[model samples]
Target: MTTPRLEGRIAVITGGASGIGQAVAQRFAEEGADILLTDLAPCDATVALVQGLGRKAHQMRMDATSEADCDRMVEMAVQVFGRIDVAVFSAGVKTLPEAPRPGVDPAKATQLVHMSVENFRKVIDVNVTGVMLGSRAVARQMLAQGTGGAIVNIASTAGRIPLAGGGSYCVSKAGVIMLTKVMALELAQTGIRVNAVGPGYTSTPMWDAPEDSDAYRRAMSITPMQRNGTPREQADACLYLACDESSFMTGQTLHPAGGQFTG
Candidate 1:
């Protein structure tokens, strides 16, 4: 029998309540890693899924934008599990709610020109700042433990390929990619690896358009695969980055983008 890739490892995953984050938690657990799942919402379902996989699981509600919350998540992971071998920063927002304003059409709010400053800032705060804070906290823990670990940031193809109206999301993901490179460079000698997974149009809550909707059709038309990627597919990319299989890799962004943007 093949041994589990993450046997006896401990992993911390943010945004684990649903979608890609939940899938990552499940995948890690199946590979024999104990998990601490943190998210803004409750993660009972995710914890249950991990437990069902016969791996230990814990859940904590976390606000990704708060520095204190980021530190608390790292601390909590250490408290629950002896040490963290992997940390996945997946907490992010595709967009933020906009306040009622004249001349602002809800449908076009995501456009760069129509996007409110507040909404853009919120997206940046949650997507870029949150990842930075989370990764920093986790890196500190790994340094203190004196055991090198892996950190995977969830990015998107939007970072590399601009979307018509996804200005905030694209910019934020681009920031994440650059941050991953910087982190990897700084932590290279420390035995810690920092990488990113830029998934294509995956089937997640963030892309919950009706199958027959024009939005869905347009998205699929651009994907060479002509189908949306599953959360598990994205999780697999993350798994490779987090495991020994990718020991030689750092400061890289894997794109499972269905040929959307070949890098």
Candidate 2:
């Protein structure tokens, strides 16, 4: 029998309720890992998807920004799967920071001014701080278990861009990249690995199109691949971080940007 890539491993994936997170949950389950899926909202659908794959699965409503809640989720993962072999922090929130006042004309050039402090902070709280809390707690657990594991923090190309007043989301993702490096260093002694996946203009339902409800044709035209990526493509990248094929790798960012940066 072929050895499944993630056979017998245990994983905790946050933001598992939808989009990329849901994609990861499905991919991991197919790889033969028991999974604990968490999100701020009910995860019944995700839970069903995983279990339907004939894998052991558990779901819980999680508020990633809460320290206490994060602690509990980690605890639950250990109790459910005995040890966590992989952790993928995929929860994120996005909005154009100074998104011209609702209903404003898009053709008019709007000043990319500083967005409301409250709005900026809110994005940072969930995207950046949440990734930190999840990584920290899971690292502690993996260390105590005496078994090395992998961590995949989802980042974005926006992390490397100015993003106008959409600064909060971009900065938060950049912080995730740096945190992945620092944590890889801190956990090197424990044999655990850490990395990040940076995706650009993915075809997730978050961005809708007029015809097929996909990405704008204009955006796809710029990508070297001439198309946005599927959630599975990004999830496959996460799997590399979770699996042993990347055993020698750590503290890196895997760009699944479809060559958006090259040209």
Candidate 3:
């Protein structure tokens, strides 16, 4: 039998309820890692999927934005599986405030200037602040254990480019990119590696769009690959970062944008 890459490891995944998070959980479980799934939304589906893979799985409804919740989730992971070998911060808000409505022209839709502070702040709070809290909590546990760990933050290609109507999301992901670097540098001695994966135009429910829709066409125009990325592709990148395969790497971002943003 072929041994799994993550055999005997434990992972804590936030935003485990859906999309990229759900994909990662499934992949990690298949690789022989038990999962501790937490999210603001119900994660029964993901938990069941992971468990079906024959790996132990646990779930907790958590607000990633809450410092207390982040810490508690990490604690719960350790309690359930002894220790956390990897952490994937995939919990975040979509770049666009809302999906394109049918027959609505995105170009003529609400612009940034008309966007509300409430919406912008909410994105930052959940995306940037949540990353900070989760990374910190995971690092703390790793430090206590004295056995270094891995943290993979899910950034976006928009972080490396200027999105016309995605200023808030771009800014937040940019923050995540830099934060990953800073944490990586500070924790190098402790053996905790921090990195990010920047995905471009992934086909997720958050950005629901038909292939013939303008929304999909617009995304394809900017992407050099002329195609949308899949959640599994992003999950694979996270798997690389979370596993010992990238042990020598730290403070780096793996962009799986299909040539969208080379940087």
Candidate 4:
């Protein structure tokens, strides 16, 4: 009999309420991993899904932007499963649309810069700072355990290429990419590998606008595949990074953007 890929492993996932996070929890559970799911929203549904798959599951409400929450999440995982073998940092905020103004030309819409400072900071707080906190907390625990582990961050194609009206989100994700490299380099000696996955126009609530919405149309235009990626596809990339198949890989960013762009 063949052994399951993640058998006996304990996985921690943030933003596990829905979309890519929920999909990852399911995929990891199917691979036989016990899961600790956390999100700003209730993650009970994802927990139930994992339990149904015959794996141990636990859910906790966590605000990814809070340092205390990030620390608590790691402690909870250890309390429940004794150790964390993999962690996927997927909690993030979507790019907010620029507000409509009277008499503004639609032709130069992309050139308009009306984004607020508060909005920019909020996105960074959750995406960049949140990942930093999660990685730090998990790395500390893994170092104590002295067992190699994996850290997978969820970046976006927007991080590779600047998109109009996506200034804050783009910058935040770019920060995540660089942070992954730095984390990988620092933790290499400790046996903890760090990597990132960049998904392009994924099918998630973040882009839940109507198909005819400008955002959706814009995403479709730049994607070479002419379609948004599925959450499961993004989850598959996470699974690969979390598993031992990519043992020799670290400080890398895997672009699952359907030929949209490579970097």
Candidate 5:
């Protein structure tokens, strides 16, 4: 029951401003890891949260899809923390049925089939390419450090099974799962591990219509747990997969999926 499993390690978490990403940063800090959190905009709030937990941390703005941004974020973490033992790709955007923004909602404003091609490409780029860039960038530094490390990508159960309204999101997550396997193979020589977390119906603010979202509730109903999982539970799973406790594990997906995906 030692709480400091990650004492002295440095971890960089992207998309740490909200949802599962935020939870992971907080939990990692609690485990004694010095952290760096980045998001599309400023990560000030996440920075404050981690520091409030009595751990050292810094925040940066990053767009994971940009190689330059990803590299910069990793470089800053290494410079500040001296090394990067872990990198977690947890930033993602979703496409809900009732999205109000023209870019987000397909059916709104009678734009179902009329949605911009740019919007679809944006979702795929951020969700899939973003994970790849972050993982690869941090891995290079880890290889140079030559101590080996871990990388965790946040994927969804939607990738495992499917969600009716999660068009591009589902595709993007599926790509993430595959990318993990590929990266794991390529990085094995360095003792670096690559893995993914497939979250079930998680009870996070990211679930568009929270209390009354029928589509979200419908996803939960199929779970054997019969309820949504909390961010902390999923965060713990991410922590386990990120730590040496899972030393024998690599190139696989750890599902905190509430029995939702029998596969």
Candidate 6:
């Protein structure tokens, strides 16, 4: 039998309630890692999936934007699992959840110039600042343990290839990529590795446009693969970066972008 890549490891995943984060939790568990899954939403289903894989799983509710919540989650992970070997910071937002202005098209609302300061700040706070806080807290724990750990931040192809109406999201993901590099450099000597996964047109709850919609069609046209990537596919990328398989890599991004960045 093939040995599990993450055997006996402990992984802490933010945004683990659904979508890419939940998928990462499941994948890690299947690789023999115990999981501490946290999200602003309930993580019961994700917990069940990990438990069904015969791996230990714990769930906690967290607001990634809050520094206290980020620190608390890391503390909880150490308390429950003893140590954290991997961390996937997947908590992020594309736009505000509130309905768009009555007369303005939703697409227009997302344009950089039209975007409200509140909306841009909210996305940055959750996507960029949240990753910073969580990574800081987890890195501290890893440093104290004196054992190396891996951090995988979820970025997006939009960070490199700007989306017409996704300015905030693009900016936030770009920030994440920079953050990953900076953290990796600072922690390289300490044996902690930091990397990013930039997925394009992934099929997740974050994507809700219909197949016939202009947004969906535009996404497909730009993706040479001409199909949305599954959460599992993206999770596989995260797995690579989190495992010893990527020991020589840090301060880099793995783009599972369906050829969106292809020349």
- Give lDDT: candidate 6, residue 215: 84
User: Residue-pair clashes per candidate, as listed?
Assistant: 0, 0, 0, 0, 0, 0
Positional deviation of residue 124's Cα in model 4 after best superposition, in angstroms:
0.5
Candidate 3, residues 1-263: lDDT per residue as tens digits?
Answer: 87888998999999899999999999999999999999999999999999999999999999999999998998899888999989999999965454565665666333466555777888899999999999999999999999899999999987888877788899899999999999999999999999999888888877678889988888888888888889999999999999988999999999998787543
- Model 2: lDDT equals 0.84
Model 6 spans > 4 angstroms off: 97-107
Worst 10 residues of 6 by lDDT: 95-104
**Which candidate gets the maximum lDDT versus the true structure?**
1
In the range 115-226, model 1's lDDT, one tens digit per residue, is 7888899999999999999999999999999999999999998888888778998999999999999999999999999999999889999878888999889888778988
Minimal lDDT window, size 10, model 4: 103-112
lDDT of 5 by residue, 51-84 (tens): 9999998998888889999999988997898999
TM-score of each predicted structure versus truth: 0.96, 0.90, 0.93, 0.93, 0.90, 0.96
* Model 4 TM-score relative to the real fold: 0.93
User: 2 or 4, which is superior by TM-score?
Assistant: 4
Off by over 4 Å in 4: 97-112
The Cα error of candidate 4 at residue 20, in Å, is 0.4
Q: Write the per-residue lDDT of candidate 4 for residues 1-263, one digit (tens) a residue.
A: 87777999999999999899999999999999999999989998998999999999999899988989999999999998999999999999976544565766654333426665677888889999999999889999999999989999998888889877678889999999999999999998889999999898888888775788886788777877878789999999999999999999999999888788631
Candidates 1 and 5, the one with greater lDDT: 1
Which residue pairs show collisions in model 2?
A: none
Scored against the true structure, residue 77 in model 4 reaches a CA lDDT of 95
Off by over 4 Å in 2: 96-112, 209-218
Per-residue C-alpha lDDT of model 6 across residues 85-117, encoded as one tens digit per residue: 999999988866435778777757778777788
Q: What is residue 236's positional error in candidate 1, in angstroms? A: 0.6
